[model samples]
Target: MSLKELLKKKETAIVAQWFDRVVNTYQLDTSRFLKSQKDAFANPVGNTLLQGLKAVFDETTDRMDNETVISFLDPIIRIRALQDFSASKAVGFVFFLKEIIREQTAKETQGNAALQAEMLLFESKIDELALTAFDIYMQCREKVYEIKANEVRNRTFTAFHRAGLVADWEEEPRH
Candidate 1:
């Protein structure tokens, strides 16, 4: 498939918006990221994942450099620990990345079959299919589940709620 065909309106804009947010979000706690301490470690794993994903899924290039996008993506990728398929977080990353990319692609591509095929092709870029982007997302999600479960077990959340650590939406969202 041609590059232009692969990068449709939905996918392109969504990818662009996400890239922008990743780089521009100032309040983003670097601590939330895994490889936040690594320097421009030459294609730092996250950058490679994001850039490679862009090249494979997107065709346009406006303000975001491939490297910059990669830098933003690196932490996300690390959080998923895609490189370590055995890691618990890999599933969450895959689901998150895939949903984000797929949503963007759907918005831009209008759910085109051609675009879907192109996206399927991009999956090959990931080192392990089992460790795909969606998988990483699932892993993260599972981790969150585990944490919440622990909190419930220890009644930490109850204590926190009693201590007024809950949000003001009225109550904490159910897991």
Candidate 2:
């Protein structure tokens, strides 16, 4: 694969793809959504949606266009889409946030430093955030999968406190 392809294989691209999913939640396809850009800023509700669209669009990549903002003094909100991520960190963490993206977008986004520095900083932060989120997922899964400790000890040579059945002394009482 080319460098672009490789970068796309990284999490930054995957993260951008997630934006694509979020954008469509409004029933607007990418091309159609962007096509409505100008009119989007023309009305009150249309303008609010437009602002959200621009923020998410800018978040998906490191670039922005003046046309993105309909007019003066638009708010610069941090979308937190990409965290400060290293290439290696991305390789390690991308899948943790998989629930955030749709499958098809999983292709195409590999990104590069070509994006603005601020964008790069946001993407890079994925390293830490991914790890933290994954850890939470693992802990929840562990508790969910935890087996009730077999209380075989109650009927064994040594008496143990537990409900139903006796367990070997070697078995721990806690999950």
Candidate 3:
């Protein structure tokens, strides 16, 4: 079978493996909660990760578009970006798909030159996904920083204004 066909056949197993890998990145308490919860509200992060991987796996390997890939990944990335994870830990789940794919296709494509080449091509798609993920992760981090700065500004504004430390106040027009 062609590499794509093999991947399509094993999509469910691949997604399950990938999801497990992503959840394992969390602390044990979080991982336990994620594993046991199924509702999207109860486990939004886990649900998003699972749904995103499934969408990715459903794409034709060669035809996966950047926008669709990013859309699928953004939710999971945003959640991780707001958390305490380093950049690698936040986006490294993309690479986990490679291991899942490799394990799933190993026996079928072993020593087969043409199939092996196709598998490499598929792996390249994963690499592209990882790059896209990094971009999304950075953007999410920037938003998080912006939010934190705004919160600090809001809390400090009243104190600074009352003490006349912050001038240039643009008072609202009276109704």
Q: Which candidate is the best by TM-score?
A: 3
What lDDT score is found at residue 84 in candidate 2? 37
Candidate 2, superposed: residue stretches over 4 Å from native: 1-115, 150-175
Q: Give per-residue CA lDDT, model 3, range 53-138, as digits (tens).
A: 78876763647877787788888898888787889988988898888788888888888999989888888888888898899999
Predicted candidate 1 versus true structure: per-residue lDDT over 1-175, tens digit per residue: 4424434535656555444444332235532241253344643543544454455344222333445444444456554443444444433333344556556555545656766666676544433433444444565567778888997866986787789877867575877
| Decreasing lDDT order of the candidates | 3, 1, 2
Q: lDDT values of the candidates?
A: 0.48, 0.38, 0.84
**Which candidate wins on lDDT?**
3
Clashes of 3: 0
| Per-residue lDDT of candidate 2, residues 1-175 (tens digit) | 4323333455455445543443333335543554355664443333443455445334333332333422211221111112233323322333333344324333433343333343345444444444443444444345434532333433452443354355667785877
